[model samples]
Target chain A: MRPLGDDTGPAIEVRGLRKLYGQTVALHDIDFEVSKGEIFAVLGPNGAGKTTTVEILEGFRPREGGTVKVLGEDPFRADEEWRARIGVVLQTTGEFEDLNVREVVRHFARYYPDAQDPDELIERVGLAEKRNARASKLSGGQQRRLDVALGIIGRPEVLFLDEPTTGFDPSSRRDFWQLIRDLATSGTTIVLTTHYLEEAEQLADRVAVIVGGRILDIGVPQTLGGRDTEATVVSWMGPDGLESVHTTAPTKFAADLHARLGGEAPGLTVHRPSLEDVYLQMIGADTAATAALASAAGVTTEDS
Target chain B: MTVLTVAPARRLPRARLRRIASLGLYRGQLELLQFFRGTETVVFSLLFPVFALVIFSSMFDGEIAPGVTYSDYLVPGIIATGLMVTGFQTLAISIAIERDRGGLKRIAATPMPRSAYFIGKVIMVLVTSVVETVVLVAVSVVLYGTHLPGTADAWLTFGWVSLLGVTACALCGIALSSLPRNSRSAPAVVAPFAFVLQFISGAALVFTDLPPWLQWIASAFPLKWMCQGLRSVFLPDSYAAQEAAHSWQLGWVAVALIAWVILGTVLCLATFRWTKTRDGG
Candidate 1:
């Protein structure tokens, strides 16, 4: 991932934002900053206030406390011009089923002063042939592409994508990632919230993980949950069929093996926690530690 | 070949034109698209007043109160009731559906003004009601030999009453839609209440046979006054002689319009939801 620039002002800045639902606390003093022209991903399990935070930023919901500013204006109190600078692609679908793809795009293009031509945007999203087709008739991935087309039509400075590729097939998800990368390259700030670790690893300059309404950690995806710096577990086939070694430094072990043998050790492999594994462990550390004891008794425990 | 070195010229007029067309023609086209796709709504709504007119006219063929033919009295009332059902009731159902499906929330997130959304919908409903009104008028004249308003004044009255009635009902529809939990319950909840208003207050079936309390309640709703005004326009000026007073029904029209304009504004402002998802979730 490219390093996000430090010179640009924060495209989105939030401090101690809170939202309550009667006795239930949906978000408890959440704080984060997204720099301009950077792809910042909010990674979290469901019910962790990701949607709530995004809604508040979009000016659809009022926050209970703290401050939020988008593009130098307080989002909650900002007027339509401020809204024009931001684009949002929500999770819900099939709302504009009656309108054809081109019609829907053209309709939304009216909302902003500086909008791209509807036809060009439709073609860019690879829905040019389906331009005259009703949105409801489009495939799941196509609908998602249309959603992105609608989102970016406004020439928005900041885009909010909430699980944008949730129902997309692999190829479509890759295409969407490339589209996002192109937008980011052209200096559009993007804030993405997704459940897929691969999506975050591939696209995010920085990712923030939230659990139970609080951010557990925020860093580059490869480094998040300390996966990059965490100890590597080296496993190899030995006289006893297989033996494993865990250590902070794997390079020294490799050097020792090179000295012992003429070259690479037989069946030798070194692995650190995968991003998915690291994420699971970070989210369910207590559960994983407790399960380790049960697994020692020759029993496997279910995922948390 | 000579290459001319030229700076990019500003295209302000083209930009402005694009913006205007985007807001107006594009949005208008979308409303038209939704209207065409809604087949079930069209079938049920079209049959409703037509069926009511046919059934009620047949049952009261011999006598419809006094002097006036059953068709004459019934046409105006059915038109008024149809306006209520289509303009107000249908608007409510559409709004509820948009809200439930997250359509309203999506639009709200856009830069489009809330006023634009309302203006587009109201325009769509008014156009539909005008077309339906014309169709009914043509059907009445062809099948039942119904007469059109004689004077310019009568025609003027018809136009004004239709405009005001549609406005009042559409606003009332917006107000009523605010009560439903989701789009699915909208028809189940609105249909029964709407039928009650149509039969009792709309003066559609038996205006004279209804109880005094029911009459008073019906009198308060705009549908009652709208039908009465139409009765005046379609029937001879002497039509009000069957009622308590001659000019009193016209007074009712003015009063109903005022009450609806004021109260309907309050209700719409209070209940309209821009987002279906609850706060914080």
Candidate 2:
């Protein structure tokens, strides 16, 4: 991966972003920053304010109270010039009924000052064969590919994708991931939200777990919630039967087990928490209890 | 596959007037293409006026007033009704459907100006209205023996009245579309209003003996002025004897239509929404 340019400022920045629907608070006190050229993932359950945050960043919704800066400008007041620099792939694909793939992309291209060739974009999204097919005739995944093609045709500096791979089969999901990776490699900042922890782990340089309209934790995916540095589960056959214990020092425990057995420990195995495990723990219990536990365990829960 | 170079991001200048005009033209062309390709829209917009003419003309054989046969009087009224159906009803329902389906929201999220989108939509509706009018007039002339105005003065009156009437109806349609909660409810809300207006405006039957109160109510809307102005163009000067003012009242027609255009423009701008409220974050 190419190093993020240090001289350039963050691609996105938000502080105290708040949204309200009547009396209900949708997003409360949200804060985060996406570095230039980095893949940032926002992982949350449904109704967790993920879409609200993304929409606010995309300038599709108004913010009740917050300071938001995308590409060093306030998105709420930004004009078309600022909009031209950002691409958004909404959760629901827009209906372009009667328009074929090439025609739809070509039509959207006219809105931008400088847009990629429609034919080239079609090939980039692997829709070359379906270019002549009407939008309504394409399958769900194929329609999503067309959405991505339209999203990137303007060569956006920051691309916001909301649950981009929700309905895709595994193979198509993988192919879509590769397309995103290529865009990231070419220095586009990506901010994505997904219900898939594996997707966040596989794609994001850093991930933030948001629940109940609040950011619970943010860090590198592997070490989020101290999953990488926390205790490991060691399991083996004991004197009577199988035994398992959570320990901070797994290697020492295994060596001691070997010495006691006078040989190789039977069925010996060690496992660390996966990203999903860390994510679940961060968002699972009462917020106060989770915070107390993190403090007790000396795990740093500050945003990275 | 060929490797394409992805350009770096740069700050583009604001859209210039020339670019907006060209883009609006392109969007209009695409809209027209989609409209023509849809079988339902084409048949409803084109054939409905012709059908109305045939059915209404066949039912009335006597002269409506001295020197004005029922067919002659009904031709201009039917043309006015056709304009309302195509300009007002069709535009409103289509915009509602687009909003419900996320198409309008998607375009709004782009860099395109709202004015440009509105312009494109207006142009599409205007073009469709023009086509419907020509076909309906042709059918009236050939089969019903309806005579068009030969003098340039009458033609000029027809030109401005039609232009203003169509613009006002199209704008009102867009404004009224926002009252419906969803696309399904849009037709229910707009169709009844259109039907009542057509009835009161004398599109369905000549209303020479219409109640004064009802006539005042009908004159409040653009459809009434549209029908009256069209009648002035197609009916002989002597036929004006049957009118309420004993004349065509061309001046009042222009005033009422222009006032509607202004009022409708304001209402449309105030109520037009690209996305449904429930869909917003």
Candidate 3:
């Protein structure tokens, strides 16, 4: 929580990071930067090296080759003082055995130089009602909430959340997103990895898609893979029954359709590509085929 | 978005040690709570030694040697076995399970010093060992009429020997836990080995008439010395005649237990891991 003299500096910087398990490479030449106060999300399929990257950043795993700096210090060589400034929520929830939610959170709080009050953190993570419940007795989603509470209780300058909302219910996921936003607004740099595209799209200021041990692309979620400028889809019920067209200019196409119909076009809709569409395309997949499948199901790609 | 004022990070060097100690104590307390909550763990740690003492003593009413009831002689040995169970078996099995379950890995990710965790485990094991020993001794003295150590010298010997034995066994347990592939396999590997040592060391039965080679093998392990040292405190001085060396050999017992303590410490440092897949790092 220290006031960084130059607030403009990136909170995390990784360059040419490489890792290998025997002959199989886990990460190959990965590079990314997360600016201070940004919510950065890393999206990848299973075995795509997302966890490897986050683990390296959290100082949990040693990288074979890379120059990685978190909070302007090499995480691999960072001391306890350096560690005190960073918080990590691992994919696996830490089992507290007999300790209750509040006890687990409060026990972890002492490890930090500047920690949030445990009671406030439990409430912030929406676990106040379950604060006295034994950690193992809580449901999976509640345990994940406890994981997040422990992560942020450190009052870290940077927080690493590895699939933080994996088991959260829809409403709790939304609540978690709001909590993350609140943290980012308070200038806490958050780097999260998640398989949920909607989560990345909703939470990340900038997102990176990684596949096959490498980064496929990194950009603002809306603009990745030129999603913002991708040809929009125009759909309507026409004379033939239903018709849809993908065009660079949806407004002109819709107007032409309305003029041709001589009045209000039934079911007229304009839709740009969604984050999932751009993500699938960036990962070297055929989104057009998925669009066809949606069309066959009477669901327009625009509706998706 | 409301811009909240971030508090300046303050380093309280003065409170750091206090914080670490408190956290370590908290962790120890949690471990003890979990241990007592599990009925199986409580039964195994607290009652197993007492049960063994009763069954063995009732089965063998005769003396193992002159002037020493088999029941009285077995009291100290059972106390030694209690130490091994609490310090060795319990520690190894729990650590393996915790590692398999990602508990240790999660603690590694936190800013808590790794030493604090080991310290906490040591504290938990030590307290459990004390409880086990006290219960076993109290039961033996009351029910079996086993003689308690009388002199200050006997008490001092009992204190140091039990302390060193528990420390050595606990460290060895932690080191050996790293060898098991998972928690399920941990007891499979450690229990048989512990049982073999207890059997040969006369903790469960008298192995005095065994081959010299077998006696030497048992002596190489700390449990034998632990049992012998405890017997020196509780049993009459004349009971030394029944021992392998025809004397208490307290000096050799001290040397062997101390050596294990040193070796176990080194092995634990070299082999211990926060997770099963992760190495020493």
Q: Pick the candidate with the highest DockQ.
A: 1
- lDDT of each residue in B1-281, candidate 1, tens digit only: 00111113233657645544456555655776788686777766766778788888877776555667767878988999889888888889888888887777778677665566777777778777887788788888888888988999889889888888888888889888877888889988777767887787634664656787887888878887888888888887666767544453676697787789789888987777776747343
**lDDT by residue for model 3 (A135-174), tens:** 8899989988888887788788899987788777889989
- Ordering by TM-score: 3, 2, 1
Candidate 2: docking tier: acceptable
User: Model 1 Cα displacement at B238 (Å)?
Assistant: 3.6
Q: What lDDT does model 3 reach?
A: 0.82
- Rank candidates, lDDT, best first: 3, 2, 1
DockQ versus reference, model 1 = 0.32
Backbone collision tally, model 2:
0
For model 3, residues B186-252, the per-residue Cα lDDT tens digits are 8898899789998899787775867888888998899999999999998899988888888989899
Fnat across every predicted model, in order: 0.55, 0.36, 0.30
Candidates arranged by DockQ, highest first: 1, 2, 3
Candidate 3 chain A weakest lDDT stretch, 10 residues: A295-304
Judging by TM-score against the true structure, name the best candidate.
Answer: 3
Please write out the lDDT profile of model 2 over residues B95-159, one tens digit for every residue. Answer: 88887776776786678766678778888988998899899889988997777789999889888
- Residue-by-residue lDDT tens digits, candidate 2, A45-111: 7778887788788876778898998988777667777777889886554467688988999999989
